[model samples]
Target: MDGRVPAALVEETGRWTFGVEPLPEAADTAARLRRVAGLVLALERPDPALDELLGALDRAERALSRRVPADPAPRVGPAADGDGRAYVDHSRHIGAFNACFPEYTIDVDGSRATGTVNFPVVYEGPPGLVHGGFLALFFDAAIQHHNCEVGEAGKTAGLELRYRRPTPLLTDLSFELTRTVEGTRIHSAGRLLSGDVVLCDARVDAARGQRSRLPAVSPRRVP
Candidate 1:
């Protein structure tokens, strides 16, 4: 069989991220893959090993992500309350981002803080069960905050999610993020617990960055 299938995919699309899914430009995956292959074949080189080809692509993708780790949008919440928790953003669409859903709070007091969100009946997805996606959100925030606890804030580079058991909507779920420093990469393990039962767990790779540094600002001012 010819390797043209994969080659054609790479040639048509210059890069996977440039022409692929979920981009602001357009959410096209199949078309992008085809384009990528076409670009690869147009090259002057002859047949290269499939493994070698994949390796080159992987390197290029990682380089792209390293340049922009996290969304630069400002998501600052309301003024901090005396207890160190405040209801700043009330999101109705994504249950995870909204503090109104489970009404959870994070205490940024240097070390790790426990985030507990009580899933109500209204948040149910399955038959009297909380949606699995919300759990991922819980872990995401928890692990992210874990890095912030120890004076090291980082963007999520990689995340591995696992669902152990069905989470009951009526119950209250508590999540905690434990941090481990492995080189410059900050590793974290997040757990979703309802009383004694384990609901879900996740392994997150958060990239360390300096909090004091600011992004390059444009010369234009916001007058």
Candidate 2:
């Protein structure tokens, strides 16, 4: 069983502290994930992606460390118990979200907003298609904007999606959110557009729930 381990680790690192040994005799899917993890751990030479991953992790650590943990609410905002809506600036939030989905952008229309996301091979899953899980995330984010018209201070209660076609890798896909209602329950619809073709449609149901009892931030007025 030790021989099943890769030479890169056994020869260089000598012993790996994987915490748990692989039980390949288990289900094939889990078995395969473990095998990949072993190979990944055993690599000695730094792959191009390794640097990107390390950089991302480092940035994430710094961001989390910088987050204010002492406050029950935002650092420079209204009290959480207030009726203020909880929201980040569309541009600021979109820029941050771009860290993961590089090709995403915010489309502002007055107070309403929509976002467009384009995925490439770096996030590819199927042979020539984007992963369903990833597609769900895009839909969730796009539809969440529909809540902008809602009381502007609630969390999502449910999300529904219907994928119409294989979201092709490297395609210029756009997720357009159409706001429906914006009150006690925020309702919005989302469509995945590959040019003019519709690939998926989604809906979000957001309610006046609280991640905290604290009031959410409202956008600052331009000086």
Candidate 3:
């Protein structure tokens, strides 16, 4: 297929609807926090002013820690919150802020998907290049995201990546993917590019299953 996203899919613009709505307040807070973390990573040297900021953050962390105990359940699947909705968390791809997750944006149409991402310094591994592990994680998220958008997704069975060139950090990069299905196996192939140069590529394999078929999350008890 051509490298361009089909005109049909381009016309269907908007965020994918497979996931439950993100909490607007939480999402905003996360975005702010992520920005701060990125800035901290970009710092050239220690600053005395950070001491006061760190102290305040410490207290805030302690206070917030008491409000929510950690739940070990996975966040993606059927009735993840016991609300009877099939939810797919796309926080890594779009919306919601996760300091550890590499941020990116994606657009999907039928069995093909495309997107752009800018790796921050925090994800750097080799000098100015992004960590190889993060690229693998990004591919997994993008492929699963495409699956969910097309209304068929499941657990990642396997993922393989080939690095052709070092992916630089703090620069805009683009990627494209095409998916094919065979029986219960879903196969997706993707390429990460800097202009016409392919920096890396991946093939992800997943098992096709219905959201209702996924194991249910145990309901949390009210205190």
Candidate 4:
């Protein structure tokens, strides 16, 4: 909802706890990275000063890379604690600190939701328009966010989108979503809008399953 969770809703739903709280440090770093990414795309020509920045970034990358080895493990889903309770770290649902993911925020109100997003210049596809694929990705995340907040979420069975018009980049846009639950299936429909004009719309179908039924993550050995 727009405000905090209603007490009655929490009592009826048994306290919806799915996503973990985002660390402030990680959030700050992500905001900085996003700004840097935007500037990288906005540059008109290669500036000699960028070479210095690039060298510094390369050194930082190598320094960080040496500290950890790659592990192919699922970061999302049910992780068991010592007390035998499942805890899911869904911080990445809203992009987390991952620079590759599109960033947006949604507010859930019962079966309906609303949110706003501004596609950065880095996400541009055509001349001054946001990529169609990114719009689809944003809709999927927004709908799933709405479903999870309402206490009913599942794996996406299917997703369909319709591009009514080209969505512009670097402009504030809003969206709305409505969800319906039918037995073990959840249907969510959403639309991206620029003021009153609809630029894109999406429908997502997900198959609901118990958290216990989710497969446990096993890290893969790297050679």
Question: Which candidate has the highest TM-score of all?
Answer: 4
Candidate 2 RMSD to the correct structure: 18.9
For residues 72-97, could you state the per-residue lDDT of candidate 3 as single tens digits?
33433333444232233452355344
Which ten contiguous residues of candidate 1 have the minimum total lDDT? Answer: 13-22
Can you give the TM-score per candidate against the true fold? 0.49, 0.51, 0.78, 0.78
Candidate 1 vs candidate 4, lDDT winner: 4
Candidate 1: regions farther than 4 A off: 1-102, 106-112, 216-223
Best-to-worst TM-score order: 4, 3, 2, 1
**lDDT agreement of model 2 with the native:** 0.52
Ranking by lDDT: 3, 4, 1, 2
Evaluate residue 134 in candidate 2 and report its C-alpha lDDT on the 0 to 100 scale: 77
On the 0 to 100 scale, the lDDT of residue 37 in model 3 is 74
Candidate 1 residues 1-223, lDDT tens each?
3111111112231211101112332224323444455456446665566458789879978996665424443222221111221122211112333322344555444445567767664456788787877666656765654554445656789988888988886566777767777777888877788887888889888776643432321211122
lDDT of 4 by residue, 174-200 (tens): 999999989989999999999999999
lDDT of 1: 0.53
Question: How does residue 75 of candidate 1 score in lDDT?
Answer: 22
RMSD (Cα, Å) of candidate 3? 8.3
Q: Which of the predicted structures, 3 or 4, would earn the higher TM-score when compared with the native?
A: 4
For residue 13, model 4's alpha carbon misses the true position, in angstroms, by 7.4
Candidate 3 segments exceeding 4 Å error: 1-20, 70-95, 217-223
Alpha carbon lDDT of each predicted model: 0.53, 0.52, 0.72, 0.71
